[model samples]
Target: MIYVIIGILILAASFIWMEIAERRIQEWEKEK
Candidate 1:
């Protein structure tokens, strides 16, 4: 059960990181 919880947290963090990276890329494109 503890391992399952850790897995879920990691998934959530990766998703959030991806979203932030996407937004940064969009902003960079707009500047160009």
Candidate 2:
């Protein structure tokens, strides 16, 4: 059970990080 919770947290963190990276890329492209 504990492992399941940890796995979910890791997945959520990675997903959020990906979203932030994508937004930054979009903003950078607009500036160029």
Candidate 3:
């Protein structure tokens, strides 16, 4: 059960990171 919770947290964090990275990339493209 603890492992499952940890896995979910990691997945959530990675998803958020991906979203942030995507936004940054878009901003960079606009700047260029």
Off by over 4 Å in 2: none
On TM-score, the stronger of 1 and 2 is 1
Go through the candidates in order and give each one's C-alpha lDDT: 1.00, 1.00, 1.00
lDDT of 3 by residue, 1-32 (tens): 99999999999999999999999999999999
| Residue lDDT tens for model 1, 1-32 | 99999999999999999999999999999999
Question: TM-scores for all candidates?
Answer: 0.85, 0.82, 0.88
Candidate 2 global lDDT: 1.00
Q: Model 3 off-target regions past 4 Å?
A: none
Candidate 2 lDDT score at position 11: 100
Give residue 3's lDDT in candidate 1 (0 to 100). 100
The TM-score between candidate 2 and the true structure equals 0.82
Q: Write the per-residue lDDT of candidate 2 for residues 1-32, one digit (tens) a residue.
A: 99999999999999999999999999999999
